[model samples]
Target chain A: MKQDGLTIPGLLVASLVGLILVAALLDGRGAHATPGEERLFLPDAKYLKPMLIGFHGVAADLLWIRTVQYVGTHVETDRKFPQLAKALNLATSLDPHFLEPYRFGGLYLLYLARQPQAAVSLLEKGAAANPGRWELPHDLGRYYYLEAHDYARSREWWERAATLPGRPDYLPRFVARLYAETDHRETALELWSEIYRTAQNDSVRSLALQEIERLKAGSSEGPLGL
Target chain B: MTVAAIALNTFREAVRDRILYAILIFALVMLAGSTILVTISVGGEVKIIKDLGLACISIFGTLIAIFLGIGLVSKEIERRTLYTIITKPIHRYQFILGKYLGLVLTLLVNVAVMALGLLGLAYLWEGVSSVRLFLAVLFIFLELMLVTALALLFSAFSSPTLSAIFTLSLFVAGHLSGDLRLFAARFGGAVTKLSAETLYFLLPNLSRLNFKDQAVHGFGVDGGSMGLSFLYAIFHIAALVLAAMAIFERRDFK
Candidate 1:
């Protein structure tokens, strides 16, 4: 009887210790990796599509927010943005009409990731998906002119944007100036300044500031010298 | 009079169900939570709220419909209460229709509460509400009505658990039926294509009823399509309910 009593308490103590040890091990494993590590493995949009059960828009919103957070977290590190494009792709694919991810994700790809081709592809996809929205084409024009220096393509995109309703008043002026091929540096400076002022976050603002400084230094060197 | 009495009784019984209230509370919380969620977004805050809110109503309303609906006939039969109702002068079809209507009425009330919460939140955030949002809600209600009909149909012949599974699978399949046709056209062999095409035509094309995208983006849904979608939903519900009645009529109490 005494042995049985002792065995029960002993078994209870052993179970408690085992649970504590298991929890500690799990917590330690979780703490070893950054939280962002877990989000690195996002499933393809095709797999998630059926599971969303018509909540694709909400899924897009949440994924876009996750992309934003991922960028903010990794922007100060290697600035690799390894999953940024994929996250944005998934979000946009889930709801093709969602415009913010396309525009902002394009910018992030262009400036942060230094993948202008990827950025152009994303903006082009956005343009194709949302022909009525002028912003995608407008952003494409800015990207080609500012990042790629593809003046001809930039001019074409700006002209397209000019025809779209709700495009900014300045797009026509930009298109006409592009036709003239005059004051590229000044135009870039003005665009970057506008971006700096309207930037939503510190990282985007700092990126715009860097471009503004580069444009200013280039102008100081000489006309078309740098 | 008999159908009305059974419907009213079913409605009274369903309204008192804690599961209905629980699902409603979760939905309302999610709708309210969308406001908090929008604070983190840079732009399209109103769009985010509307999308999330509308999704919450549709998803939770469907859950309520399925959970309550699956139990409607089965619980009656399980408790032997259905024996009394069947032995009455009323037909079995009346009981099934009454139960279906009762659950749909419950869903209507719950969906209305969620929709109001969403509209109130959207107005608070954006200071404007569109008629398209309400149109989206109407389509969502139609979707829920069909889902309730599906649950009623499955519950007429199967256990509650199996009925819930069947209803849930049909709900998923309904949404994906459009994609199934696309897949058939793209990748399916002749036999597979024929089968996929047949299933696609037979299954409800729920994507046709989705107006959340247009509603969120402030696009107008054409009148003809809206009328067609409504008619489609009504026809599907009528077909499913009629099938359920046919099954229930043939069921033997002995």
Candidate 2:
């Protein structure tokens, strides 16, 4: 039998089915309750702490997103940092090995949230679990130097970061400058330049390079010129 | 016995198709490429890998299910091989079931290889094997099985082009049935609600089979939930196959 041409009714039926399917898939709301919010507790709360610690990585991811979302735009204030710190503490405590909440939670708590103390605490947890990783300690040093402005603490953390395997070559110089003091600004600019040049990821390199340029433009006649 | 032979032959034929290999290779490359992409991600690198891996598995696996499954019976008919097979003592349902099973075997092998690759890559990154990942992959296989049934059902009564379109549409609807019910109840009028309900029942509800998000995050498997999902897939496949058998049994090929 010869195949019949495309019939109008057949086309309409197909169109209706297509429309129905599209309408179905376009609805993307998740389940009503957030996964791990109910289980949050402090380490001092021993009975509740045990339950909180057992929550899984997916719950940790959700809590991390929710915690950041909850912290909102007032992120730079000390008030916002504590709330975020509390949530991240809960999240990472639940799933200690989850890499994202550690990196992102620490960045938000330290840099954006302006709680360098809390950031240090969180990154310390990450470092303890993920021993030998250079990034976590490097972040710890960044928080101390840039946010806390404690040169001594910054030098200590940077020294630790430098000793870690897989650390960049210029980290040792940065750690040395923290103690030498004489050429610290010039060394920071140089270190940032190396960060830009040798960074593995483009975005990270871009951010580092931008910061170096900003520093240079600010202190044109300063150590940046040398 | 003849039906088993035909099914085995078709399975071998599908395995050898260059299109199948092309899709398989592409999916593997993307799954592995996710590792390199993870390094660039500022944070949530592991989540990114799992997200991309799971999405690739579903999309590529669905393509394999629909393309091969839609053509299984129609290709036989088109090539006039169905006439020879139909003239034998074998029943039409056996032929249909055998063809469906053959495609399913192909999908199982493809899904297993992809799942193992995803699991291995994830373990390499995390340094721990996730039992949840394997369970999530099993759910993906069940999802594909529902789609294979849909394709076979459509092919029983329609042209290959129509069969492919209908089956793909069914796959999409099944993925979103829960959301569709919500939309209908909340905003749609009476007619829309009824139509949505009808579709909800007629199409396989594949969203029920998705434990990927939960599993990917290393949340332990909910055994009861997985059992329910398996039952749902099996029931859907049974209904579709029965419908196809009924249609094929009545059709006059003379």
Query: In terms of lDDT, which candidate is strongest?
Result: 1
lDDT of 2 by residue, B86-112 (tens): 888888889888888888889999998
Candidate 1 residues lying further than 4 Å off, grouped into runs, are A1-39, A213-226, B186-194
Off by over 4 Å in 2: A1-226, B189-191
Which one is best on TM-score?
A: 1
lDDT of 1 by residue, B1-254 (tens): 78788888999999999988888999988888878877777667888999999989988988998999899889998899988877789888888888888888888889999999988887887778788999999999999999999999999999999999999999999998988988899999999999999999789888889999988988878999999999999999999999999999998779
Q: What TM-score number comes out for model 1?
A: 0.89
Deviation from native of the Cα of residue B151 in model 2, angstroms: 0.9
Give the lDDT of residue B94 in candidate 2.
91
List, residue by residue over A1-226, the lDDT tens digit for candidate 1.
9999999999999999999999999999987786446455578888888878788989899888777877877775557777777887888889888988988898888778877778888888889999998999889998878766788999999899889999888888888898888988888888888888888778788878877887777744321232
Q: Evaluated on chain B only, what are the TM-scores of all the candidate structures, in order?
A: 0.97, 0.95
Model 2 Cα lDDT, one tens digit per residue, A1-226: 1234557667889999999887766643322343223333334322333332122444555565566445542432223444577777777766666666666666566545666667778899988876667877787776666546667887887788888888878778787777777675576577567657755444446657777887777753321122
Per-residue error at B119 for model 2, in Å? 1.8
RMSD (CA, Å), each prediction: 4.1, 14.4
Lowest summed lDDT over 10 consecutive residues: which window, candidate 1 chain A?
A: A217-226
Estimate how well candidate 2 is docked, as a DockQ score. Answer: 0.08
